[model samples]
Target chain A: MIILIDDNPIDTFIQTKALELGGYRGRIEAFRSAEKALDYFQGISTSAIEADSFILLDIRIPSMNGFEFLDALQRLDKEVVSTFPVYFLSSSLDLEDRQRANTYPNVVGFLEKPLTRHVVAGLPGIRKAAS
Target chain B: MQISIFARKSDFQEVTHIKGLLKEWSPKVFQYGETARVGKLTREIVILYKPQLTEELIRIAAEVRILSPSCYLLVIGEGIPGMTLFHAQVNCALQLSEIGRIPELIHELKARAERITSDGGSMAMQELQEKNKELEKINFELDRFVYSASHDLRSPLTSVLGLLYLLREEVKAEGAQRYVSLMEESILKLDNIIRDIVAYSRNNRAGLQIEEIQLPELISDVEPGLRYLETGEITVSGCVKVKAAFPFSSDRNRLVTILNNLISNSIKYRHPARLPEIELNLERNGQHIVLVVSDNGIGIKEYHLEKIFDMFYRTSDHSTGSGLGLYIVRETIKKLGGTVRVESAVNQGTKFTITLPLAYA
Candidate 1:
């Protein structure tokens, strides 16, 4: 499963298309804000998340930012939190932002914006065998 | 100079003796009992220490210190040591026999007043320093604003570029394909200009962040970003050669900016008759690192070579760039305490030789 959290609708739409074009055949979930995503994560059961599920979070967002959301996620059951890894997909080229993102143990990678076919193909657990 | 004296009525004879010595200063005498009514002290105040009024003297001295922090306080007499006198905010004190030092003390005070007045007063210096601090704060705020503003600006441009690529892929008609490609080119040009603007501001505002830089990694990182610059039948490529006798450490961001601009410019002005190529050579040259970026492209004329690094100075009428690329490169080089020299010939090529300090202190 692929989870995308971005405030821009155009970016979300492009990401969804990029994923589809890159041959990602799985459940794709997207949220327009970090708050909404956190709410959904809180409501879901531990069993609902598969081993392949991961999050693509944006750093800049309204109300609750990516870092604040990560702080909130720490309060969830450790088992559920440990089940999936997170990656940052942002437009920021700031070195400080990349270093800060690395401090989060769950963040596996940092990708620049306008997610392309090349970037999607590099993601883990999104590709499945032909039906 | 004006001196204010606070003393007991019984010490009138001693006060008169002290008054005779300090005749140079018009001393204003006040009763010790009227300490509470001492209103708005501006100049020097002398307190005649009496053993019984020790507590009162300490309290009044502290009050004066707090009310007028710049006011000088002098306590003259026995019973209280100099260390204890300082705790009560007393500037200095002297015994009855040491009364001869009064003029010397007054002379020192007069000199201090003159120094303050000559330097436009300590108050003025404080105000000037405060204004400088405020300006530094504003400059910091403005740098942050530009950083975030550029990020905000680039986000939408990338979105459009992505959509344009998607559109180009799905469009089947040749005419529509051509139109999509044209729009893509226009958008990419706009994106380049925006990127240049960000680089210019960043070079002007951001401080140098030194890091260990592998020559091959830096060159490879820059090449992929400019992949789109190659189109049609023209093939633009870069060849890098490194002769590193030792480790090289410098500002990574600034190095990236310099390389990106130079390589992009080489591609932008590629020779139409041949496959354009960018050649980068990095070598250690005695306490410094020298990088040479040479290219076989449409080289600048002699008249235009000197003006190329000037801000917003375009080399030719056909140039479509923001004209800030070379300017930013020059500025970034200057900031790193590096020097850049250009040598070129019309229709043949251009070469830029840059020398930077190995370790920037």
Candidate 2:
């Protein structure tokens, strides 16, 4: 399962295309807001979220940003947050952002924009699926 | 050299004695009840120390310092045992017994006044330098703000462009295709404007890196981008003659930015009936390199000639430009120790002559 969180619909669409092109046949879920994604996570049982599930999160968004969402998720269930691999997908090429993203224990990678098929395939645990 | 004394009304007798001794000086006296009125004065300050109201005296002294930092604070009272700390904060602390020696006190006051005047001038200068540093920091932050703002704006536009690319393949209807192409054009225009803004901010933030620039190659690099934006053939003349003096020393990026903006502007505001023509001429003039970009486009009005290089000053309401192109061009030119001037008539043509110092000083 892949959970994509980006406020922009066009970004989400592009990411979906990129993911499909990268040959990921799993279920893909998208939320325009971090709050909505949190709500979706809260409604589901901890065990329902697979260990292989990936979260592609954008850092900048209205109300609850990517870091705030991660903080909220940690409070909800630290075990569940630790289980899934999270990747910060941001348009910002700021070094501060990359350093901050790296501080998160579950954050697998910090990827720049236009999330291409090659970038999707390069994710740590998803490499086998891409191959 | 006006001196004002502040003290409790109960200490009036002591204050009066001091005033009578220095009768020639005519010091203004303020009762503790008139502390609020003390703030209105713009004279050298004197606080008559009352041991009973030590806290109040310190507070008033602090207030006076705020009102005028250079205002000399003269403390006149018996030197109380624990008042050394309080005395340290003031310009001069004097004993009542010292008041009887008028000539000595006046000499000390004269010396203190001179010290305060000199110290105040330096302090004010230091404050101005600190303020200038703070303003420079704020200007840098503003540049960063423009960079981030344009970056964020570009993100959404990138998404729109991506979606449009996908939609071109999915949408088979002729009308839908036409709409998609129009949407693409608008998005591209917006993208270019955002790029220009980001480039402008980057120019302000980044330091100059002087390098040798190949004239024909630089023009060719800018040509494709402008050609992509225009519908008609852009006939670029005078590149061959300029290419021989191939390597001109300057900040290449800024020079390219100036040329790009001028070329883009020429393409953007081209006269509908006339095919767009841009003439480029570069010549070595004394210690400077003179580059002229003359375009037969919809020229500026006579009144707008002065304001065309000002930020956000667009001539026509129908124009879709961000109004930052010319301003950025002029600014970048200025940063490179260059000067740009424009000449235009409404229906005729516009010519911009830029003279850049050959070396980065």
Instruction: Candidate 2: list runs displaced more than 4 Å.
Output: A1-131, B1-149, B165-178, B220-245, B345-348
- For model 1, residues A58-126, the per-residue Cα lDDT tens digits are 888778888888888877665676446888887665556666887888888777677776557656666
**lDDT digits (tens) for residues B148-194 of candidate 2:** 77668778776776677567657889999999999988987787777
Q: Docking quality tier of candidate 2?
A: incorrect
RMSD value for candidate 2: 14.6
lDDT of 1 at B131: 90
Q: Which one wins on TM-score?
A: 1
- Model 2, position B92, has a per-residue lDDT of 41
Residue B112 alpha-carbon offset, candidate 2, angstroms: 16
lDDT, candidate 2, residue A105? Answer: 86
